[model samples]
Target chain A: MNDVITLAHGAGGRQTAELIDRVFKAHFSNPQFTGDDAAVLSIGGADLAFTTDGFIVSPPDFPGGDIGKLSICGTVNDLSCMGARPLYLSCAFVIEEGFPLAKVEKYAASMARTAAEAGVRIVAGDTKVAGKGQVDHLFITTTGIGQCLAGVHTSGTLARPGDVVIVSGDVGRHGCTILLARNQFGIDADVTSDCAPLWGTVEAMLGQTKDIHVIRDATRGGVGTVLYEIASQSHVGIHLDSQSVPVHPSVRGVCGMLGLEPLYLACEGRLVIVAPECEAPAILDVLHRQPYSQDAAVIGQVTAEQPGRVILRTEIGAETMLPPPGGELLPRIC
Target chain B: MNDVITLAHGAGGRQTAELIDRVFKAHFSNPQFTGDDAAVLSIGGADLAFTTDGFIVSPPDFPGGDIGKLSICGTVNDLSCMGARPLYLSCAFVIEEGFPLAKVEKYAASMARTAAEAGVRIVAGDTKVAGKGQVDHLFITTTGIGQCLAGVHTSGTLARPGDVVIVSGDVGRHGCTILLARNQFGIDADVTSDCAPLWGTVEAMLGQTKDIHVIRDATRGGVGTVLYEIASQSHVGIHLDSQSVPVHPSVRGVCGMLGLEPLYLACEGRLVIVAPECEAPAILDVLHRQPYSQDAAVIGQVTAEQPGRVILRTEIGAETMLPPPGGELLPRIC
Candidate 1:
């Protein structure tokens, strides 16, 4: 497998199989690979869910994470957010030639560790090597499969007017860290990336209560976009008290100085939940017990009147429309 | 979805849902997204299978195709070559900001068209935007889930002595096409990319015979690498007649003049199958009926005596070992 990729590797023949057996199958041994078009696993009557994601973050490797970790976590989080217990992940690596083996090893280790932490296994994978300069060091794609809860029907459109919005943690950390890392700005905040497996938090809330209307991870486009989407999907409007939406002081400082809206900044280890008003406190309590989600907050509520709108009430009692931003303000910070 | 991705999009909140709905969900819609972790699809009780792949090929958009289409085809083909009837595909796009929307749409169209050609639906997807130059314009990740035929115990390691190896069509065309597209090498050949869905050929052959021992699509590392893999997997030796292995005359001339080995070139559309001696002719006939597979030929046979080895009988009737190449002779051609 250490032999460099040539065109012949993708040929539907011996070499392709060898590569599969050595790199993918060797790492992700399962009974599902028992000779079929797709690996067939005994479903055991649980509802199955599937998700796919591509990782193209610049530098493939970054502080506290890499494309590999993102690939696994992205898929696993999607599975869990859908109320599904993640079971397996399939990965593909599209690598540029001349990528260092050391970097590849670290990336793979990160993937292995994150998948293990998330309680999922890498069950299948493929690798394609492109020419140098044709691609960055590496890009990863991950597909996740999971088993769903017996009677949950969570959806962005499922939110009702009385549903309360809960924040899993502070916002703007991931985006701010990526920005500071890229600019080489000397921020003394010890801003380690917020990238982590959120399955624990998801499981905690799911276990505590089943009244959750919608659960989403606050990632790209930040909280503003998420609220807007829920409003549009559920045909409801959202009103957020900016003071109630928690932001780290450092993140606040950065946003204030740069004129970047913290509300629009990305957060990795965070989620916004729409739940019945009665269950918001319980959900928050459960989330806070998790080490990664201590700062969970109740940020807003869903409404029927201002459908498809997301507005934030500033401390000055002024309201501003919170829409999705124009483009990526920072690149490859993930 | 076309805009730059922010950290909030990945947050498990309203923003994340918006990213899915606006970017990914719009592009890939299927039953898989009906709020389940893994898609609950019925393929006439076929064995469930899954494949995942990442696309980091440079120039996200290439001459004949782009990362988007490759992301779709590469994964679909992985399942298809294994005799799986592809059911659904999930896509994840990691885009960099300032990338053109027009190019993204073109790539999307290509992906959608390729999925249709492969008879699979684009079911679930995710989108992440990175900073410019932090990544290429875009990287696509595709995961395919399918149902494999029951009792199709195909394995690279399963090619027993006396198994016949048949290639679906001419090789090296895809690899050479990229050479011209990228290097401006004036070696003109009327070879359109052999880039296509191989499930049609697999379907044709599977319908004709049940004893197809192994199947693989020749991609990176070309025919030689694939053959080496099969030998290693099945713990058997592969013996080939060089004259019988298909190579276009133009490809041959180019290889000779450029000192490149056609056997090591990448192929997108072609597949190689190992079948029992009794089923070889019928399989070839079934493949011949498909226009995409007109050049199907039996180029070699499997053996037991020299396990884990590949021997090619040259045009001059001299036997030589064709080990996997040491490095990538051609890059980004897939």
Candidate 2:
């Protein structure tokens, strides 16, 4: 490992995994330590899921959400991915000195509203101030506690051959929105962050069936990254039908202009779910009835052939291997 | 509140309270929202304590500990303050892009070691990297979940008129150490931080008696701030015997030279405990036997004379009110 950390170390891809393996995992290796979205804890004879996420999105506010809402949604979705019902969340903020107090209140209000919508309580918080240039405008780290539903289990390692893969909604909206929010490219396009709490969506799916294999939010590295993670974890291949993948028109246009692969752009509200082939339609039926998952579509399937690879069958029917995610593409795009 | 946040707003004193009241409390007002160290949660038919704290201590490494050890100790102590046995912890790190990987590893090792001592598992974690100047070296926020003891209930508001106040050890070491670490005054002192996980100390005390009224760790604003908070919350007066208050010789020398109040300096490993007068000796006995609290002493008693006030009685028997803490004294002390 390099002596100094780089942007790629936090990119939520291979480099991030390597850092975790070499540093965090080596020291914090315990029976309950998690490589999954959340840790499944057995407290007082009941299963609970615990997770934390640090949000450092630049611009603080984008089209659909700000860091506060993103902070809450990020952790809520993490617990939801573990088949848990979000219960209580604790937020810790490190605000740069001289940041507007009204803006902080605005973020808090957004957090409260988002927590209310997700059926989670914002119970505990800590605030600290850093000197003007010591930190960015603000950063919020949210940790969540969730109760695992009975007989429900989901993990990245659970992906299996013949399982259908579904995405909860359109991809790349959040990353594209943040990219445009930076305004470095000067590209004019309509894009909104797909940032929302996914507990309700997960709950609805679990209510329909408990046979889900894998559930992961496509956050930092988006759908492509999550697929690679699942493939590596489950030792299975993923075959994507590129034409069947849902993408917002604005996001598609932005990606096309930038020559960026939409598949690797981040999404805060979407989920990549793997379940039995027979239960895919049933799960999609439940997801379609939900507001956040109305665009739910089966974009791929788990395969026994070519383990640890993601093969995309393009719209023109030509098959090609999707390159694995590596170095940082967009820093602080969480 | 001012239009923009100032350093005093995060000082953990009067201004910090105002910010919490005007912004966070106003927006996140809920039955479960906390004004104490940690929130008592009832999940899955079990009582659990949940809390979060962000550590941005400058010069990340210090005499007795670094940011990593402080991070674990902070959240573990918060849960311990709630009379909860520390169980699971989740840490989120926001690191600057160019931080040294070796330093990060050192911090992580310290965290792992401290969590092991506290009997807590680092079950989940998240890491994000900001641009070179967007953040300081690194900031760590740890959230913990602990199973609340069956019959023990401790809060800042539970102190009674006849309760006795105990200082778990010599105070002001942590804050003084930080002050000296900054080297702004060019004065050298042999002081080290009192940063340690206090679950063992609390566990030993609970083993002695569950009648303890309150247990608070003096962190940012120190023992004086904690005492004032308890006085205000319980609506009772605190009478301190100034001569009986324990202070290490080096800490006292530093404070004497700097005209700083030892009572107002932070002590990371110390506790300001309140309990019935009859239980004081037993509690002190247990604390004294423990390595961390060998200097435990009964320095004061709760009184009904002046609610929401702390009176210090000198050796000559003259009583004076301890000035309430306000504004910023030391930034990033914790």
Candidate 3:
């Protein structure tokens, strides 16, 4: 590992994982500490899922959602990925001193709205103001606890050969939006983040079926990175029908102009799901009817060949390997 | 309300309370949300306590403890105050890019040790690295879920006239330590932080009896602020025997030199306990036997004479009202 921290360490890519493995996981590993979006624990004769996420998005706000909205959606989606019903959330904020009170109030109100939309209550919170320049604008860390829906089970390790790979909606919009918000490339497009609370989307899909094997929100790292992680965890190959993957036109344009791969860009409101091929039809049927997943589609499938790898097929017939997720995408993009 | 945040907003004093009320409370209030150390919720037929705290202590490492240890203690102590058995904790970190990897690892080790001593599992965690110059070295936010101790109920609102007020140990060591660490005063004192996880202390005391009415840790604004909060919550008066209060000789000497009130300085390892006078002897006995609270002493008693206020009886028997907690004492003092 490198001796000093870097932007890549917070990019939610391979470097982040390496750092976590070398530092936190070395000491914090225990019976209930799973590297999944949330850890599922048996509490009071019931299964509960708990997770936490830190949001330090640069600019704090963008089209579609602000940092406060993103903070709530991020954690809620983690629980939902575990097939849990988002229940309660606790937030801790470290605000830069002299930050506008109106901005703080605006963020708080946004949090309340987002929590309500996700069917979760903001039950506890703490705020601390750091001296100006000690911290950038503001940061919010949210922790969520949810009830695991009965009879529903999902894990990254559950992907298997013959399982269908489904994405809930168009991918990479969130990343593209943040990239342009930075205006580092002197490019502007009408791209908005695909940031939204996704518990309802997951709940509505699970209502129609329970045989799903894996469900993970594609966040910090995009759908491509998530699929790579799932492949390694489940020891299966992922075969992507590249043309079937969906991407918003504006996002595609932004990525094209910047020579960025949309597949590797972040997606705040999308899910990479693996389930029995037979159940794919039903899952797609339900997802298409939901607001957030209307563009849901089967973009790939799990394969027995080339274990722990992802292969992308061209629209014509050529086959190529998708490079492993690595390096920093965009710091504080979430 | 100020147009911009001041250090006082994070001082955990009157200004902090006002900010919480005007901003957070206005939007985040819900049935399960109380302005206590932690919020109590009924989950899966079992009562639970949930809390979140952010640690942004400057000089990350103080005389007696580091940010990692302080973070764990803060949340653990919060749950302990709610009469809950600390169970699971989720931590989120925001580190400055280029921060030393060894320091991060050391802090993680400290967190592990503290969590082990508190008998809580570090079940979930997240890490983010902000660009250099955007954040001071590092900040950590920990959220905890604890199983409420059966038959034990403690709240600031439960204090009644005639209840005894107890100090678990000598106060002000933590604040004094941080203040000296800043090296602003140039007055060197052999003082160390009283930072420690107090679940075991609270557990032992509760095990002795569940008759305890209120329990609170003296953190940012110290014992004085806590007493005032409890007085306002319970609509009662606290009359202190100033001479009976225990302050470490070193801390007292430093405060005496600085014209600072020991009662207004923070103590991370102490608790301000309230209970029926009949149970004071037993509580004091248990507290004394515990390593963390060997200096436990009865410092005051609840009174009906001055509701929503704290009075101090001087050694010469002259009584004066303790000033309300206000202003920013020491920023980033944890």
Per DockQ, the best of the predicted structures is 3
Computed on C-alpha atoms, the DockQ of candidate 3 is 0.89
Model 3, span B1-334: residue lDDT tens? 7899999999999899998899888998889987999999888897889999999999999999999999999999999999999999999999999999999999999999999999999999999999999999999999999999899888999999999999999989999999999999899889999999999999999999999999999999999999999999999999999999999898989999999999999888999999999999999999999989999999999999799999999999999999999988878988
Cα-based lDDT for every prediction: 0.69, 0.94, 0.93
lDDT of 3 at A209: 94
DockQ head-to-head 1 vs 3, winner: 3
lDDT of 1 by residue, A184-266 (tens): 66665555467778887888888899889898876665777677768877899898998999888888888877889887776
TM-score for all models, in order of appearance: 0.82, 0.99, 0.99
TM-score of 1: 0.82
Model 1 chain A, poorest ten-residue lDDT window? A33-42
Instruction: State the lDDT at A175 in candidate 3.
Output: 90
Worst 10 residues of 3 chain A by lDDT: A325-334
Q: What share of the true interface contacts does candidate 3 keep?
A: 0.86
Select the stronger candidate by DockQ from 1 and 2: 2
Q: Judge the docking of candidate 2 as incorrect, acceptable, medium or high.
A: high
Instruction: Give chain B TM-scores in order.
Output: 0.83, 0.99, 0.99
Give the better candidate number (1 or 3) by lDDT: 3
Clash list (residue pairs), candidate 2: none
If you assessed candidate 1 against the hidden native complex, which CAPRI class would it receive?
incorrect
Pick the winner on DockQ between candidates 2 and 3. Answer: 3
